[model samples]
Target: MIIYKEIEISIHNSIYVATKGLNYYLDKEVRVIIGNQQESDYVDVIKYIIDYIVENKPIVSKNQNIGYYSWLLQFRLEDINYYDLYEVKTDGTEFIKGCDTAISIIREQSEICSYYKLHPQFPSFNQMVVISKGVYEGKDIEAIRYESPEHMSGWWLITDDYDDDIKSLMTVHFHHVAFNRPDILKYLALPFGYRFLIDNNVIHVSKDDI
Candidate 1:
């Protein structure tokens, strides 16, 4: 008698499903499941599995064509600015911690903002913690502002308070501006936020995982 086995693995919070056949054939799929109900939620998962089989599970080429897939992912993630964090750091110790914390908070907020379509009138703010060795030479850091299509604006600004022998700087950026529609600004901001998270290493996944 011949038997088949199916296996599942979770990597970086994403899931992969694989199958091994009695005849030595193998199959696998990578996918993201949004909700708990229905097998239709597994459509992308299944398609990926089929493609994997057809392509013989080749490693993704660095130059492989992503095209619209890239855009689609960007569209879902939102707008984010990494320069804002870099501009505020005064030293290495403070820079590392502050950057990490900021990235984490921004990732959380981005998801909330994306889900709720956070209103521009109600802006969000958070402090970045820093631990550094260099003297924090207090200097005014200029703001980099971004305007989204939804008529929303984001402003990253440094604080007036400075710690001598500067290790880190505390800065705040607000992502909110009243857009014409309720969720327009939030949607526009997701890609920016996603990019920021990626650049800062706040969230990570293999190219094959996505």
Candidate 2:
């Protein structure tokens, strides 16, 4: 059996070293939270969430910086032959039908992890929710090009302009700002050097810190 403890150090170190720069640009009050959703027992559920986001998020098209949302349903419904999950007719259909399937799977997994005998040692469902919502919110931000940085780009969003209701619902959400490039995984794994700042700090605290 793969033990989480063995890999935790590497994961944590990678995250810290990757995102250290971006964290400097964020507000001092903003906090960072990192959870190993991909390492948990319910890895399938996490993969489903990633697939859902990939299928739904706006894709850059040739004509426009932002792709047409018209093709969203069609794209989502298209047969996803990329993974074994799609082997089961129910799998692809569930996500394609509506957001309900995605939500249900997440909820079920959350409950399973929550009530497991080793709950205290396992990652919490709330962490998954926080990360998911944060990623969704981050994707909505507009990408800005940086000339001096030699092809580097970044995403920026003003907190004040965000919908109050939506912002309220995202109480545990964290900010993510990184360039889209070959290093996308490095960025997504730990955007803005958030992990570094958290690690270097004497005491780290966030809305969800416990």
Candidate 3:
């Protein structure tokens, strides 16, 4: 078992110092569920991803430049404006997916990560949802992209303007973004200075280890 993980940087092997953000969440675990019907519901893990990324993005190492991963996703609300109204929903501890804003980002990031075969610098669901050319659960779920202007501050809408609901399990399917599975996400490594940090899950290094 791993204790409080005291920045143990071994010189024998390539290792780097872990950041405070990665250190604190080492013991915690997060899970996400997608799609639902009847009441038209879907677990909003986007909010959770966004919040975690934003809070930790700054403390992360200099190599992990996650600035392009927009912290604040601006959107319209069917003509309604909620100036500073923030998300209040919760997924146990992190912010729940209010709508498609976060998911859209997730989809986009997943595509890029898949293309490059790399993981994100922040903790997120490593899953994929492609456009279903076939019909699912009686509805033509083309994979809701959450491209609407309305923002649900308290809860996430089940079916986005384009996506489908999980009325049944066989209705649709999702590809898990398990970049590093079988092992805890926090256990992933990253590069720091001339060395590499052991078990740096979120922050990924893009260049060669020098």
Evaluated with TM-score, which candidate comes out highest?
3
**Relative to the unseen true structure, what is the C-alpha lDDT of residue 51 in candidate 2, on a scale of 0 to 100?**
38
Please provide, for model 1 over 1-210, each residue's C-alpha lDDT reduced to its tens digit, 9 standing for 90 to 100. Answer: 111133332322332222223112222222233333233323333333334434564443211221111011101111121111111122212222112222333344456555546421223222121212211332232223333333233433223443443436433222111111122222323332322112222333111111
Cand. 2 Cα-lDDT: 0.23
Candidates in order, TM-scores: namely 0.20, 0.18, 0.21
| Candidates' RMSD to native | 17.2, 20.4, 19.3
Task: Give residue 140's error in model 1 in angstroms.
Answer: 14
lDDT of 3: 0.26
TM-score of 1: 0.20
Ranking by lDDT: 1, 3, 2
Locate the minimum summed-lDDT window of 10 residues in model 1. 68-77
For model 3, residues 1-210, the per-residue Cα lDDT tens digits are 111223221111211111223324332122222322211111223233335544564333211212113222221122111111122121212233233333444455455455556554322232222322222212212112222222211111121233354432231112121211212222211111211122323322244332
lDDT of 2 by residue, 115-160 (tens): 4321211112122111223333333222211112212221122222
C-alpha lDDT (0 to 100) for residue 95 of candidate 3: 30
